[model samples]
Target: MTPPANAPTFLAQHGWEGAEIQPLAGDASFRRYFRVLSEGRRAVLMDAPPPHEDPRPFVAVAEWLAQAGLSAPRILARDLERGLLLLDDLGDSRLRETLDIAPEREIELYEIAVDLLVHLHRQPPMSGLRPHGLDQWLDEVSLFPDWYCPAVGLDVDGAGFRDAWTAVLRPVANDGRAPVTVLRDFHAENIMLVDGRAGVEHFGLLDFQDAVAGHAAYDLASVLEDARRDVTPSVERAMLKRYKEAAGEGERFEAAYWALAAQRNTRILGVFTRLWKRDNKPHYTNFQPRMWGLLERNLAHPALGPVRDWFDRHLSAEHRAAAWAQAA
Candidate 1:
């Protein structure tokens, strides 16, 4: 994780003449992160190189989330043309790892996260953002048939797959509740526990450049039905109840939560496959079984009948998680 060629110049311009750069982490995307230490100060350097990645939307959304009183990282400096950004260090205490080390805090930490969503959904959706409504939902889930089916050597009914998702999601789209800002990738890994901040401010947000003006239930579902981690069913149920009660939502929200959770899991199945096959990231295959588990649970919901039936007709038990287990 070498720093980009112009990183030293960028740091020098930002008044950090001799910073120590250490690799932080990379995600499923082309974006890379590094920790910068100079004197006694620390910051994060985001390398979102041109053509493959852009840093502007991240800047805009970070500002929007901050203005909304959420804990998105503060952008210290940026060079959009070269796709470099210096951001406040949110530290290494990720929500996922925190839970891993102390399972007893699951409910407490999750309740705070749920409370953050309740607060975030109260605000109006940010202006000038793309909508992640029915159309986007359908488009995204297509990746399952587009990539996953082919990878498993199982021919699926692509048209039927779309029809099933549409049948399930159309009602969710028209469920009368207005759209809120959907932090499209609001999972445990993308969250950090800031040391000094208290309450919801303690949880810093990340990987939200794809934030959309979409269903309020979407982010809630994303956090609970995570692909990389096993959120016990009891915890998921508790958190769902927690969010619904806090937000004053009822049956319709429940329906949309399961429907969108299935939609998201289905899309991720294909996304991880695409990452492995096309993007040369085979390690993503390890998450497929977990995705399958979440999707299976989601399909059991009454609203997802069409999608469930479609899966039964096309994808079999052997073709699902079992296949991925072998691949992994």
Candidate 2:
């Protein structure tokens, strides 16, 4: 992996002086991060060049999480103008990579994750971390038809899919009470198991630049219906119930769970497609089948009448069969 032209000077100007920079391999995005070793200490240098990415969101959200007592990679120094930052190296182990340790230990580690999410949701709504405006959501969600359909070569029944998405999402995005903090990508891969003061626990929250105020269910849906791992049905149910008990009952809260799951899963469909077509990342293609199952799960709720009907008509077995062939 080649370092971008300016990375050496950029890292050196910051506290990474005399540090040896080496690429950290294996990620889907164009962003490149490095392991900086110096004086028996280590840090990470995140290099995000423009057009491909903007580091402002990560900067903003990391500060927010830090204020909330969550462990974010501490910014040792930065040159935001050049898109470089030396951060505390949380370590090399991620929760996904450590799952083989012990089944009971894995479950315990994930429980801490559930708690972090609950704490974030309890905070008052805030906007700087995520794209929160209704117009923004509509504009972003609307792009699904444009990007996803063509990417996989689906002769998308565009009007059909759009209508279902609108029917499923409009209510929550329009409501005042539906608002809550959301860590848009709360999942295993972004978490690292660390040695906590009390005991061994997961630390090092990463890729949370998209945290924002949204429907309470948004992050929960991200956790339960993850993109990277197939968490079992029993685990999913247990987590959902724990959250429900923690958040307590209200008709609107329950309704938001179904509505938010539908909205998030729909967005995942568009995102997964874009990853393959625009980003040229094929690994995400492996998850399309499960993504469809999530879509269907959302539809099964009676509140999603229009979504259910749309899936029955559009993304049925016949539709996927053709789409898979096109993808191949």
- TM-score, model 1 to reference: 0.98
User: How far off is residue 205 in model 1, in Å?
Assistant: 0.6
Q: Model 1 over residues 170-227: C-alpha lDDT tens digits?
A: 9999887888998899999999999989989989999999888999989999999998
**lDDT for 303 (candidate 1):** 93
Give the local distance difference test score of model 2: 0.70
Tens-digit lDDT track of model 2 for 1-328: 6766776776677755667888885465656788888889888888877777778778878877777767788888877777777788888777777765555565566666777777777766556545564555556665556766666455667777666666666776666665676777877788876666322234668887667767777777777777777667687767777777877746666676776676666677677777777777756667777777776776787888986776676455755544434566
The candidate scoring highest on TM-score is 1
Candidate 2 to truth, TM = 0.88
Computed on alpha carbons, the lDDT of every model, listed in order, comes to 0.92, 0.70
Q: Please give each candidate's TM-score.
A: 0.98, 0.88
